[model samples]
Target: MFDVVVVGAGPAGSMAAKTCAERGLKVLLIEKRQEIGTPVRCAEGISKKGLQRFVEIDRRWISAEVIGAKIYSPDGTEVTMAEEMAGNEVGFVLERKIFDRYLARLAAKAGAEVIVKTTFIGFERVGNALRVKLKRMGEDWEVETKLLIGADGVESRVGRIAGIIKTLKKSEIESCAQYLMSGLDIDENYTYFYLGNDLAPGGYAWIFPKGNGCANVGIGVLPSIAKANAKFYLDRFVEKLEIRGKIVELVSGAVPVYGEVATAVADNIMLAGDAAYHSDPITGGGIANALSAGYHAGIVASEAFEKKDFSANFLRRYDELWKADFGWKLRRNKRLQEFFLKLDDETLNSLARSIAGKNIREMSIEAIIAELIKKNPSIIELLKSFLSP
Candidate 1:
C-alpha cells in the first residue's frame, strides 16, 4: 500500500509527491496526459520572488525575464509599473513543457513512483485505507493508499469524488485563449495588459513576451458577460494591433477564478491547486499558490501517517497552512474584482489617468487598490459596498 496517491503531475502533484517521498513515504504520482505539461493551459507567468522561494534559478525553463508591466486603459492611457510592483503574473514567461517535466523529475528523484498516460477513475473508502482506480492503456488496475491528493486541474473529477469542492458557475470561470506568436514588435522586457469592458468584458487581455520577437498573446472573458467566446475576442484584439504577428501555437483552457471553497479537506482526502480553486481572483494566476498548497498537503499527509490518523480533522492542517500563505490575498482580490466589474469603460479610463503619473514603483494588488481609494474618491461608494458586510 502506498502512503499517498496524487492525481495529476502538475506543479502541485509533483511538489506533494516529492515532499512526501523525501519524508520516507511511499508516494505515487499519476498524470492522465500521455506527457506531462502538454497543451499548456496558462500564460506561463509567475512572480520572480515566488519562484526563487521554492527552487533554484533554472535558465532552461525561463523563456523571458520581465522588467516591468504596462496597463492600457480603454482610452489608451498607459499606467506603467516595475516588475516587482505588478501582480504575481509579471516576473517571467516560462517554457511550461520543460518546467513541468523538471518538477516531475524532482519527485522521481525523491523516490516517488511516477506514471504517465494513466487516468485516475475514482476512489472508494475501505477501512483506514482507500482504493484508487486507474486506467492504463485500456487496462484497469487498483492501488491501495492511506490518503489521496487531488491536484487535478479545474473541473477536477477527484474533487467531485472527494466531495471537497462544488461545480463552478460560468460567471466564476475565466474562459481563456492564447496563441504563441513570433515576428512581433514589442519592448520584449515588459508584459502588457489591456483593460476595458468592450475589449474583454469582465476580464482582461494580456501580452507576455517570450523573447526574440515572440510572445504569448491571450484574452480571458467571463462567460456570463462576454458577447462572444474567448477565441472570438482574442482574434478581434490581435487583429486590431498595429504589430502583425505569425502564430506558431494555439492553446485554450478555463481558469477557476471562483475564489476559495468552504474547505479543501475531507476524510482520507485533500484537494490542492486548481482542484481547490486556488487561482487568483483578479490575475487568474495559480502556480505559486499551487506549489505552496502542494507542499503543505505533503507535510500534513506525512504527519498524519506518523500519527496513524487520516481523519478530516488531521487533513485540515493542509487548509490552515495554505490559508496562512495566501488566503488574505485571495480575499482582497475578490473585492477588487467585484469593484472593477461594476465600472464602465469611461470609469476605467479615468482611473487609469489618475494613476498614470503616480509613482507606483512598489505597488501590488493591495497598493493599487489603496491608490484608487486615495485618488479616485469618485468610486469610493462602489468600493465601500464590496468592503463592508
Candidate 2:
C-alpha cells in the first residue's frame, strides 16, 4: 500500500509526491494525459520572487523575463506600473510544457512512482486504507493508499467523489480563453492589461509576452455578467490587436475564483491546488499557492502517518497550514474582486487618469484604494480593512 496517492501531475501533485517521498513515504503520482503538460492551459506568468521562494527556476523553463506591466483604460489611456511598484521585481513567463515535466522528474527522483495515461475513477474506504480505482491505458486496476491528495484542476472528479468540496457557481469561476501567437509587435518586457466592461465584462484581458515575438493573449470573463462566453470576447479582442503571426496554439480553461473549499480535509482525503479553489480571485493565479499547499499538505500528511492516525482531526494540520499561509489573503482578494465587478467603464477610465502622473514606484495597493475611495466613498465600508494599515 502506498503511503500517499496524488491525483493529477500538475505542479501541486508533483510537489506533493516529491515532498512525501523525500520524507520516506511511498508515494504514487498519476496523470490522465498520455504526456504531461500537453496543451498548456495557463497564462504561465509567475512573480520572480514568488517562484524563487520554492525552487531555483531553471533557465530552460523560462520563456520571458518581464520587468513591468501596462494597464489600459477604455479610452486607451495607459497606467504603467513597474514590477517593483507591484512588489514583484520581475516576472517570468514559463514554458509550462517543460516546467511540468521537470517537476514530475523531480518527484520520480525523490522515489515517487509516476504513472501516465492513468485516470482515477473512484475510491472506497477499506479499513484504514483507500481502495483507489484507476484506468491505465485502457486497463482497469486498483491500488491501496493510506492517504489521497486531490491535486486535480477546477472540475475535480476526485474532490466530488471524496465529498470534500461543494459544487461551484458560475459566478465563482472565471472562464478563460487564450491563444499563443508569434510575430507580435508588443513590448517584450511589459505585460499589457486592458480593462473595460465591454472588453471583458467582469474580468479583464491580458497580453503576456513569451519572447521571440510571441505572446499569450487571453481574456477572462465572469459568466454571471458576461454578455457572451469567454471565447466570443477573446475573438473580438484578438481581431483588434495588431498581431502579425498565425495563432500557434489555443488554450482554454476555468479557474475557481473563490477561496479554499469549505472543507479540504475528509477523513483520509485532502484536496489541494485548484481542486481546493486556491486560485487568486482577483487574478486567477494559483501556481504559487498550489505549490505552497502541496508542500504543506505533504508535511502534514507525513506527520499523520508518523502518529499512525489519518482521521479528519489529525489532518486538520493541513488545513491550518494552508489557511495561515494563503487562505486569509485569498479571502481578502475575493472582496477586491467583488469591488472590481461593480466598476463601470467610466470609473475605470477615471482611475487610470487619476494615477497617470504618479510615480509607479510609489503606487501601492493602499494608495490606489485610497484614491478609488475618494471617487466612490460609498465603498469605504467594504474596503476599510484592505486600506487599513
Best by lDDT: 1
The residue pairs in collision within model 1 are: none
Candidate 1 segments exceeding 4 Å error: 83-90
lDDT (10s digit) by residue, model 2, range 118-139: 9999999999889999999999
TM-scores, each model vs. reference = 0.96, 0.94
What are the lDDT figures for the candidates, one per model?
A: 0.88, 0.86
What global local distance difference test value does model 1 have? 0.88
**Per-residue lDDT of candidate 1, residues 1-389 (tens digit):** 89999999998889999989999999999999999989899899888876776777799999998877788998889887774533334488889999999999999999999999999999898998999999987799899999999999897999988777888998889999999999999998788999999999999999999989999999999999998999999999998775489999999999988876778999999899998899999999999888898899999999999999999998888888888898767776777788889889998999999889765664267667777778878677877778774
In candidate 1, what residue range of length 10 has the lowest lDDT sum?
Answer: 81-90
**RMSD to truth, every model:** 2.1, 2.6
What is the overall TM-score of model 1 with all chains considered together? 0.96
Clashes of 1: 0
Model 2: lDDT of residue 36: 93
